[model samples]
Target chain A: MSESYEATVTDPVSAPMTCDSNPVEEWLRMDRMPHIWCPGCGIGTSVNCFTRAIEESSLDRKNIAIVSGIGCTGRVAGYLLLDSFHTTHGRALPFATGLKLASPKTKVVVYSGDGDLFAIGGNHFIHAARRNLDMTVLCVNNFNYGMTGGQVAPTTPEFAIASTTPYGSVERPFNLPYLAQSCGAVYVARWTVYHVKQLQRSIREALEKPGFTFIEMVAPCPTLFVRRNRLGDGLAALESYEENAVIKNGADTRECDLGMGGPIVCGKFVDIDRPSYLSNQVAHLRKVLGDRYVMPDAWQGVVQ
Target chain B: MNADPRGVLTGSHFLDGDHAAAEGALAAGANFSAGYPITPSTEVVERLAGRFPFTGGTFIQMEDELAASIAIQGAVWGGSKALTVTSGPGFSLMMEHLGYGIMTETPFVLVDVQRGGPSTGLPTMPAQADMMQARWGSHGDYEIIALAPSSPQECFNLMIRAFNLSEKYRTPVLLMMDECVGHMLERVVIPSPEKIQIEPRRYTRKGPDEQYWPYSLEECNNGDLVPPLTKVGEGHFPHITGLTHDDRGYPAMNAKSQAVLLGRLVDKIRNNADDIITIEEDGTDDADVIVVSYGITARVCQPAISRARAEGHKVGFLRLVTVWPFPEKRIRELAGRVSAFVVPEMNLGQIVREVERCSQGRPKVRGVTHAGGAVHDPEEIYNAIREVMG
Candidate 1:
């Protein structure tokens, strides 16, 4: 690694010190200039969408927690001007799960990769969804492993060739919307990078959704997926998405399918109200910590 | 001196290791215990459920370990001493959040009742494979404190100590117990709550409406490395994520930012080892042979020590109560005195390397290990002790 690469990797943004930058942009560390994304990764788009969503959501910036796992997509949390956590690989869901459960008032969002979510963190994803925990998960599905060179992931197409598989990938990719819906997620959607407006709207909706909400953003990995498949440049992938994609008008997961991209289903898929884990927990806490909670004066003498 | 000090403790019955752990957390002023049940460790949750409600503390059986671990931290930030308990599988599930706890400097106690596993290896049986993972499982380089207790009594006592250490250092403290110790029916006495010295992390109350930094380390009266905590609902401080952060709890990724954040996380624990690490050395001063063990394995080694001494061997015992601060200084001193050190454990030689490192090539340190459900036979340790004497 050159001094520049080492410097880039180490110099992370904290406490948005960039001047005249939007207050939100001020939250970003400017010294950590030039992130480690490929020239045209869609994660930057999603990061922009997320920043816009947070700005539009009108929640206190300090009260929001953004957690990310390893991958090119994981870097979104690093640049955000919120209480963000950049956790280890494949563990972002659990970390965000903890953050959400620990403080119910805080809006916890997991900005992660397809490999980290579907491959390594599948168990956590299913469980978090099944329990209908209120959280926002933005899964950037670039269709390849961007961090460790382009390799076939659980979200990769059935016959995509990459560094790991000399031949095309034999395994079928996960239909994430269906998986999340089956796992009892109350909100689920799939959107490609070409539809940045729709992606941003889905994220905003997911943020306000009262239960587990999952958004699968079909991002282009120019270095891995494009280079391996010999697909044209990022513009080609974005153009392909714009040409082939079909948007579902209503919030229905059954209308979405990744294998056959009919009605690419980019809306709030599930929005039925369900009891969240924290609300129930707070009720339980209120029941348990009854009189002491009512009479804060009692705690003063007791601590002394 | 009378050899038998078995009755030194004020004994209480029906208080197994799990009950002891829960009661100890309660006594230490823990106001919340969020847990999901797994074998051997379930009793901790069961007991907390029955007790927490009455004491004005919250006890929640979450949907899973993932939720329970976070719920514990949340309750802690909500102005309570919070805790969670689980077995090996659940502990593995909780490791990511545990790393979050380290990065965010969250104070909570995680009781991992060890069960066998590479993956669901032995849900019902005991193994100490997680000993290494407890410290190094997470991706980043940071320090955490873990304590191992042999008896139900120590389970109660050490849990209180674990909570205190967690509060003092502002990091997660792990109470590592195995199935043999966790599920064992043992007599452990609960000390009177007044008798227990409860130390809480300082809360920053300079002004209720002032800007509060939840992660800023305030020098306590004792010069300890703990920040003043402000709970969310209390309307004081802001809490942030697992990112390497600054004093104000905002995320930072710069090299210098990481250096300062990582240094604080490590230095807090490293600088406080003298106040943290606890061990027990028996007959070590004049003995040529010694047996090292902890948790239930130490119980087995205790009788082995007595039997070996009766058989005219100069055998001693070094039982680790606090394992994470590693007890390097004490082990080094023991290595200079003993001819050979025998480490008999329930897991395959987890702590023996520490014994070896401490021995510094002076004494022969041998590991005697078993990974199954059964406790180590007293005679096996007795034999190892004698062999070391030779």
Candidate 2:
């Protein structure tokens, strides 16, 4: 329905590495190739940035988990070459919460979408943040629910046309960074899929934090959200980021509500510290129960 | 294996069924539980919270049953035996994650204390009505192991078996306790750590870098009915999904994928139903009437069955300990000889249907139904037996 500037980009011809030597190939399920993401869709771009970020992060590939809920972004887990859990709709946080509390060592990341994260799963998002659970939450905000065909979402901007809101969305949208920050997330950041380097760096930084941290990448649903709302193609949407993106490092999150095609305030804001759920549980139980409390030993289930 | 000594009470005590279930979980080496308080099931958490401090276990009061159910699955993959308990309304809230546990083959215990309900019908009363829901509540084609306990002592004893089955088969084993038994007071004996045998989780033998197939139905040397699983953090890098998955644990949606994954999910319990099912049968060999019952209803039917036998009416009792994998094969084989089956349950006829289906119309199947606030009267069961005998 729409077209944007196509990249005249090409990879430089170089010595090709075999599958065993290539980290990207090693970390991806090649059998599930030709991903479902439409051409020029921003989710694939976001995933590419994530893989690059994984390559850069200090965590081992085997110790990181990618958990997702039901949505387009939810498919992120199946494509990755890590231990992932594709759980029920809006239930990813609680599932990831269990995994983190049980293992206490895996770097758990929830990669989901706007509708899945802030809509049906809103309660879990706030509670997980309030508990300061030790995990990373990455939400790819495409302005609407992309999987079920562009329905109006909790994060859908005011007056935006969606399948449910044929006239336009009358409800004011939630500024996810503000919500996560207010709910006690230790770190909060926002970027676009177009800002690949910045997004990857922010993800790496969030992964390093020991308590609840959240990163929002504003992506484009060129197939549905863009075509339905007349918002141009995904590349044009990316270019819109180039034109309207403002690097506001410490802007008040209260003023960060995104518009249909307005200035996007992006940066790492609200980076602080708090004791995670397990750390506090361990400390409090030791003090109260004392000698009676047996420290949990993670020895028995470790595979050779 | 013996229980961790700290968790074992190693003495006889008068505890309610709910409390016995909690103690039994700890004695069976359950190190984690996530639960939300609901009627008839709250005492399980009440007991666990008080006892977990000394037992090296963790009990978290989750936000809701949805969180509680899925949270235990996390604990299972985190490297501990785990469980969650709830009542009817909360149990309904857990069906989705219940399916998740079945699909992912995660081993965790879910104890549903039966309160009467289509919707909060009897919050504080007993019902064996959830008997069908336990077997068919989750959406999809799958089978699960569900056990019903008639007395507080069996609640303690069977709670251990529940966890053992969860580990042995890598599935969510349902401890389907009803309100009557949950609140019922009886003497429960806690065995010493050495005398108690607990099945440790069947962990993966594959090395960290080895290709650990989470759902491979292939044969290991020991011939485990279920595949062993590795901890999420132990460098397995395995992927788990509720979708119909292949051997590698990746979601593959197709006819072939469904057949491979769902076929095993149902067969893992069905193929081993012989080991999973336990029942108490008496005089069924030569009885004209067999009274089929479970949970507190089974206990209620006992005196009635005994009185019928005393009068020389040729009555017998068939008590179900594992209500699901519903002893159909045995019932089918017995139908040829017995004149009738008298099924007395708290709910208005749930398990009776299973009995009817398996009977193949060989003998008359009579349902002695109740609305479920209270247990069936002894005379009611006795009358059903006499009528069936006539």
Candidate 3:
């Protein structure tokens, strides 16, 4: 654990909006709280957005499943009252991918963090998107590891101060939106806690969208990223988000080149058509296993 | 060998362990398999993919090990018996969901054709190193049923038992085949469908789904344990999680729920050990020396056992078919009768420790260890048996 530094920090507090509209409170694991997040962290915003999205869609609460990996943000599934899975770090994607495939009728959503998604689970993420497996992936990009004292991660901004990079981070961060789009996310979006209405809207669209849908929520890590950048308290980080974020159209992913000077583009990036993995699998199985199948109701036990 | 007079299955032919495993799963009524190709165990998937379709079942090559595991779970949930095959690397990737299957009590079969490992240690080589990992790798305290096949035909027969135990207990059943049995090609007699007894999944037929609780436990007059399970769309249950949960499947985070759930999950197997565990002993009744072996190593010790006994030495063989929920009582019985127990395995003395643990000082147990792709020479085992006789 790191020492708590005194804040000569004068971070402005954004006006409090209604943050407590959790529709699935009865379904959540309340005792695991207060979640291991820094005070004023935006992961709570993403979790609220997820619960709100699920509520708004009006999907069967019982059929809905939430799978998460190891990280502060990944623990969102633990607190939610759904069929939640807190699996091994960086493994939630594959686990979720499997869960969705096994029970395709069930609504499967993966909630993880940048490190969980883009670092350890990077291969599974890209491949799942490529395969277009039917699932929603909500990645909370907090730029650094919050659970382990804010270490540098794949999404940590360059030249930023983190536990591992005390001098300054020289490694470049991944452009998650562009990478996901190129890998074939039928629906892709990026939003910050700063954009509640827009974030909620993107989430709703993703839920309705077919195939692999990815939403990268740029949450604030006030205890780490913001504290070190002297960016102010967690609430101030959202205020700065409002000031600096450029929410362009989804097509802006093509124009925002990383390694070159350009604003980070955040919006609903891609929505398109593709036959999902499970549907195609079902079609193939139906065709091949047609004559052999005994309909469920009429099935006479296994063939001798 | 001649066909059985009952006409249930053709007699054994010269076949390898891999072929036996595939035919075993087929006989056990495995109709769906979704797995990615991996070494040693790849043949299991390849054979299943070809046979399942012809048998009127589904076979899918999942994107990865993780997806394969989930797909198998789904097939089982869809009311189809399914299985997946993988080795060390793939198995490592599947540890988390393997735990998921255990927690959900989803019945499925996983064939781990053991290979050398830490990372990608030795893929083609033989190793029984995953024995402990198979039981404990998936987090949480839960009982699992694992079987080791000592011969090509045993692989075929044990796989059938694996599925049955998986279905009855509602737990993931592991068929631990080392690279030796996994890669070695041997002919196996295909059992006629008439001879195979297939147990269809037990679904609740209660009226109106509300009365159904998917995980409700039931104890019969004879005190047999059964956990309630219903199909997904059926009105039987609510939520299921990796977390400690109540009977309703809803997440329950109290000690009371944890104690109850964990106990039931484990007790369901422990209480029914007689029905779940199986082993074979050759000349163990009055032997002064015994050889405890399983899977491929047991094959090497087979000839040695016969030779030791032929040489006027009271040497015997104890072959474990059920590796976990281990044949504890039977091992104890053998300990009392035998003077020494010799364990031959293709790994660094893994199951030998189990033999020592089960012997309880009644018999001196020693390990015959080997690693890498090579199997132990029969002569080595023969020598070990002789030394014990002296």
Q: For residues B1-390, what per-residue lDDT tens digits would candidate 3 score against the true structure?
A: 222222133466776777678777767766678788888889887876666545545566766887677667655654567788999999987887788788878898999998887688898888888888887888779888999886677788888888888877888999998888876766677666667665566666665434655577542234545664564434333344566777656557899998988888888899988988787777888888988888888787778888877878888787888889888888888788778999988878777888898899878887888865688888889888777766
Interface RMSD of each: 5.4, 1.3, 4.6
lDDT of each: 0.75, 0.86, 0.75
Off by over 4 Å in 2: A1-23, A299-304, B219-225
Q: By the DockQ metric, which is better: model 1 or model 3?
A: 3
Candidate 3 residue-pair clash tally: 8
List the pairs of residues colliding in candidate 3: A27-A81, A28-A81, A304-B193, B14-B187, B15-B186, B15-B187, B16-B185, B16-B186
State candidate 2's TM-score.
Answer: 0.95
Best by lDDT: 2
DockQ for candidate 1, C-alpha atoms:
0.16
Tens digit per residue, CA lDDT, model 3, A1-304: 2334544333334536456844656555565555666668899888877777777886787667777777887777767766566666676766665555445666778889999888888877888888887789999988888888889998887788899999878998898888889999998888888888889888888887778999989888888777876777787777777776787866657664333113556788888899887667556656867766332221223111
Candidate 3 chain A: 10-residue stretch with minimal lDDT: A295-304
- Identify the superior model by TM-score, candidate 1 or candidate 3: 3
Q: How much does each candidate deviate from the true structure in C-alpha RMSD?
A: 7.1, 3.4, 5.6
Which has the better DockQ: candidate 1, or candidate 2? 2
True contacts kept of each: 0.15, 0.74, 0.16
